[model samples]
Target: MKSLGEVLIQRGPFSEIVIGNSAIVRAMLESGVKVVTSYPGSPTPEIAEAINSIPKDKNPLYFEFSTNEKVALELAFGAAVNGYTSCVFFKSVGMNVVADSFVQLSMMEIPGGMVIVTGDDPGANSSQNEQDNRHYARLSYTPIFEPKDAQEVYEMFKKAVEYSRKLRSPVVLRLTTHTAHFKQKVSFGVYEPSPTGEPLFDPNANGPYIPIAQNVPVMKRRALEKLLRWQEISENYAFLQGNGSDVGIITAGLPYLSLLDVLGESAKKVDILRLGMVYPLPRKAISEFLRKHKVVKILEELDNFIEEKVKAIAYEERIDVEIVGKTDIEDWIGEYTPEKVYSVMSKFSPELVRKVEKPVKFVRVVNRPPQLCPGCGHRPVFYVLSKLLREKDISVADIGCHTLGFLEPYKVGQILLSMGHSTGTASGLSMFNKDRKVVAFLGDSTFFHAGLPGIINAVFNKHNFTLVVMENGTTAMTGHQDHPGKAIKIRQILEAIGVKHIWEVDTYQQDKLEEILKTALETPEFNVVIAKHPCMLKFTRERRRKGIIKVPQMKVTNRCTLAGVCITKFACPSFQRADDGSIFVHEDLCIGDGSCMVVCPSGALEFEKIETGGGAK
Candidate 1:
């Protein structure tokens, strides 16, 4: 069987089942995108994975995982400005990091097109927040396209690239969680390989590409002019399906799919306008649709952006229609499902509800909170922190697998804002608290992403705090993607940044880690303790690739006093407590790294080695 990368590059007149992310990759190849860049993030990481799977020799486009979303956007923008079609993508909150540069993108002239793909997480699944990036499209004066499924993900992405080039502006291809992961039989178009070789740059042609105050007004006018042009062309993209007379529903992206699923054959009694280009919406088309129907219902997730825009259009066009949007707060909270849509539509038109299929009854399942994986390296660091830190000490947390430290038993994370903000926040706490010790934890990937500046700030300002750098070797939270940390040493970066006290300790060496962490917390000045360990999952995979079939297993021995420390405080998923108050290692879950043995007060947890083709002994 061919790999996804191999299959994506296949010259087709053929069709295959592909997820939305892979379809976007195919669209990038088909659209002749020369440069591709992204920071690994949820709902969109598969895009990079698919592109990376292709053999480097066969891959046409140049791809890079930049330090952060802003840098990724800048790299792709630079390539696009220098006459190479480029693309950059990241998850919803990643838009926040890219916002500083993103707002300026539309104001600049790009001779070669640039498509900005944002995987907007509507339900907050695998995300910190369900931010609606469609707002950025309006704020930045950039055209935005939202696709319903995998096929449209391919088709609309190709169109977005073309429109970006034509408009000489960056276009936004926004996908929610569902649309990003949705799979369908996507037919392929002829692959248009991107041009190879260095991109040509003529600085003298467009002159200075700076958005200085002198040139600001003109650039703003030009951006608005491009938006106006897009508005005219966008009418063709606004699709009107079904033909109901009394009620009409306006939606975009994943919500449109839910609307269809609930309405089913009964959809013929209602007209649904699905807007492909959500921003700079085709005003003329929306106005005409509003004029035809007596009542129009808008279905969208997270925000009422579409409803507000449509309301404005209706007011301007003098269309007398009852515009219904977000009847309850619940409508704006989560992803729209068939059941959710059915509930909303049933209230609107009782007659049509009976004709359509009733939504399946929801079954309640046990809720399981997320926890660090078995043999996770971060566990030892968090466990040590939990033991050493006093209740009054300020413990700041940054994003990553380490964020789980805030949860039960080991309540280490007291304050958290965003990626890399922990150091900065801890610095503030140290400055104000004065009496209490401040400690912040962040992963290696985040250190490279947004943690460096915070570290520099702490060092420069001479803040009093202990910063724990969990050097897990890879971007573990996002599927173990390779990062700059793999090539560069965290300690070297710390030394170069003028960090005075830096201690490197193995995360699995709990005693040494605890000692180092204890001293670091007592230090009067800014200090860093580098807890080094490979993510167990990544380690296991590497070992398996090296033909090491068996991993050491850990077992709870007779020495266990049933202290519950291993089960409650350490909280390694491998350690479980039965109803009888006896603790044992869940053999199926344990990788046998023996990190848990250090935390057992009674020396109960012991490493039980398994021989080749033999059970653990």
Candidate 2:
């Protein structure tokens, strides 16, 4: 059978040819990382998905989209203790959510080499905080390796296992968005399984599994002692070296690439040292390099991580090499654009000017910052549910791509902090009044994520509220990534949850959708609505041009006077407000997907026309 890598390559919107990062692929195949887990965010997702799909042989395979970052980390740590060389991953802020579990994992040292891959998003385009996570490795005192690009990412994975097994520490391989997402030539090779040693049971040395009063202090000491070796490892860092230093710049990961790109050919003259191992300051290697340099410049993204470490090492060593960094230079924490890096360099030495070109604005296809899809299934699902709101609706939402539901037309999602809080929040809201309809909506991904436990709580505790699990097969909002419900029937999940009154609906079918929903409202039974369909735009929009989505047509009958009640309360962007304060919809914008037809209580708003070039025929 073809490897899973072949599958993604055949089906993808990947920028580069998907063949580049096969080294990591080969490593997984070799190591047999049987337990794979992730919080379905970007950059790090590919590794989780690819590792999970690896042909499970004798391996007791389990792959999951953990509800939130914290839960995902907990699962991976649990698997590690149970004797699996498990690999768990999340984006940088993902670390923030899972900090509690992470600190626990730090307390319970790894028996097998546990690799936690945290992909840093630079430039703040996709992420909330551009705070570099190398500091987490510093704070946690976990070993960290900063891979420059895909190839380096693969190399570091192999190294991570070796370092982890030897040190008995969980090694974090930090790859930036540029490094994680961008494809480059990575040589394909066979995977190396984490060496299965005898199950380590050192009761006297402090229990590795149990975080007891006796063991916690010992564990902390071991973690710190491992961190203290950063300088030692730096002394021999083969990757962290450059020639006779006319000017030495110490940079890590993708930031190093930007500095090199800015310098162009002149970079060959200026000594450049790239550290794949960042948190363990590699102080020995760095201090040696500083001795040879006439002047030292620091290049790190989003934080004074490397610069601060370098300065501290310099201060201790008393080596006076002028540090050019965030304090004296740029204040902003983000990826150094070519201009920014070049400007920093030009200031240091007037001769390094090749005058980097400011990029011209090319007409790149802007990702329509997610509004409801022209013919999205979620539209009708929420349409009928909105009527359940007697006074006003209060909801707690989870993260995933479905956060888009709160945007324009389907302003249904109320509060979204992180993943899987919707059900729990609804439980809290239920306390105020059973009359106040609190609807909690979660996508298939989020349902799998943090919602299941909360759902179980609601089911077990008999919480009085309606819970709607919008099981759109794909994790639509975050680029249609896979979810467990992607292939599996959502009804199966609801059944597994032991919910009796589960209502399944074809959201495309209008009358039946609202009818079932209407019955569900008064039923007072804890209901589960499995609105099943692929995100039409995710698959459909990518193929042929599906025309603008519109609601069903309702002719102006006897009760029709332009009250515009439907338009005012339920503000859908598709509805056009006329000059006379009357309401009309632009038919061309309508994809003939009649979701707006719901909540029209009077049956006034229906699909009027879907025209070619003119009004409806």
Candidate 3:
């Protein structure tokens, strides 16, 4: 099978092979986007991945995995200011990181135009929170396109780029998790490479680039003016219209699919207003539809953003239509599916709607919640910390795979906020709760993304806390994407930020780690312990890629007391216990990190080195 990149760049006289996410990339290429940057995130990672995989010669567009969303936006904004078509993408929560800059840029002019793709996970799938970012468009006074599928994503994204440049502002392309990941047979156009040129910033090209106090009101007025103009254009965008009927359904984004599926054949009896432009309400079109229909029902996920607008429009126009929105039948949270829509629509027409059947047998499978992978180096560190802290002390957590420490076996983190708020939150706790010990935990990728600011804030405020930098050398939670601080030691960054009393220890060195942890807790000054370990999964994959395969192995070897210490305390997935309580190693799962060897109290586990790549020595 061709990689998403290959398929995207291939001359597509071929039909129906491209996925929704790749279609965005293909559209970017067709739109002549010169620069693309993103912080790797679910539902949106494939966009950056596909771009990164394109051969340099085939498509000369510049691409990068930025340190964080803010940087990603800034880089794209910089390119856009220089008259280069640029785009930046991230998941919904990541928008919070870029929000400050995004709001500011919205008030400025971009000659080359910039497209911001925000992937919203309505179900909280693989995310800390399910944020509705359609509000962002309304907040920023920017035009937004919410594509229903891959083909729409392709067509709308192309138009978005052009619209951005034409309007001299950034355009938002809101992609929900459903649209970002769901595959469809999208008929796509061929990739057209952007014109070859060295992109440079012409300072004078776009004047008043900065957002100052003097320009704030001017920018605000201009934003409103543009929104009004775009609202008229959106009214005529073809997707906003409905069939002439007394009963109508108004929906946008992924919910539109549900509306269609639920209505099915009866859809012809009712008029439907499918909104591709979710924000800056297309008032003229919506009012006309309301004037025609006696009842208008709104179906949307997460929030009543569209519903509220529809209501206001109906009232403003004195259209005597009954506006039904956010019924109790449909949940205000989670992604909308066909079944969920049917439940809502059944309230109106029970005879027509199909009932969602509950599974008869309901065979309960093994409950396998996500855990730290087998051979994860953070396992040992977390084990020791959980032992030391117990349930008394507070361990503030940040975003990463290490956040798994909040789960069972190792209930390390008691409080978790956004990406970089851990250390800052710890600082506040340290100042108030002088008697209690405070420890802030964050991963390497998060440390770069938002952790640095918090660390600096902690130091400046003279707060007392011990910070554990889980240096796993990769963003393990969201694939093994490289972070800036991963390669360059974070200790240097900390020292420069005035955080003294820093201790670095290999995660495998349990004794040294314990000593460091004890010292950090004892010390009054702000302390940082760097538990450095390469993520075992990434290490193993790298070794395989290099064809250098010898790995350390271990066995329980009949010295087993069956105390259940390793199984219960360590919780490393590599250890498998039989029904008889006999513990053994699963060679397939073990990565030879050897951190577990130190924790085995019975000395039953013995390390055996494998001579070759494929087998045991």
lDDT agreement with native, every candidate: 0.87, 0.67, 0.82
- TM-scores, all candidates, are 0.96, 0.72, 0.94
Across 1-617, the per-residue lDDT of candidate 3 in tens digits comes to 77566766876645565667778888888788888999988888888677877876687678888889999999999989888999999999989989988987767778888999999998899788888898888888888888888888888898989888898888999998889986888776776555756765665655566667886887788778878878876875536545577888888878888777777777777888888888877887788788888888887888889999889888877889899887773468778888887877787666555655555886878878779988787787888887787456888888888889889888888888788899888988888775689999988888888888888887888889999999888887777888887467788888888988899998888888888898898889788999988888887888999997757777787887887777788888778888777898888887766778777777888887666577656
Q: Pull out the clashing pairs in model 3.
A: none
lDDT (Cα, 0-100) at 532 in candidate 2: 68
Pick the winner on TM-score between candidates 1 and 2: 1
Model 2 weakest 10-residue run by lDDT: 11-20
lDDT of 1 by residue, 492-566 (tens): 999999999999998888888889999998899999999999898898888889998667789888999999888
- The CA-based lDDT of model 2 is what? 0.67
> Looking at candidate 2, what is the lDDT of residue 582?
63
List CA RMSD, all candidates.
Answer: 2.2, 7.0, 2.5
Candidate 3 off by > 4 Å: 197-205, 238-244, 356-364, 546-552, 607-616
**Weakest 10 consecutive residues, lDDT, candidate 3?**
236-245
User: Which segments of candidate 1 are over 4 A away from where they belong?
Assistant: 192-194, 242-244, 354-367, 613-617
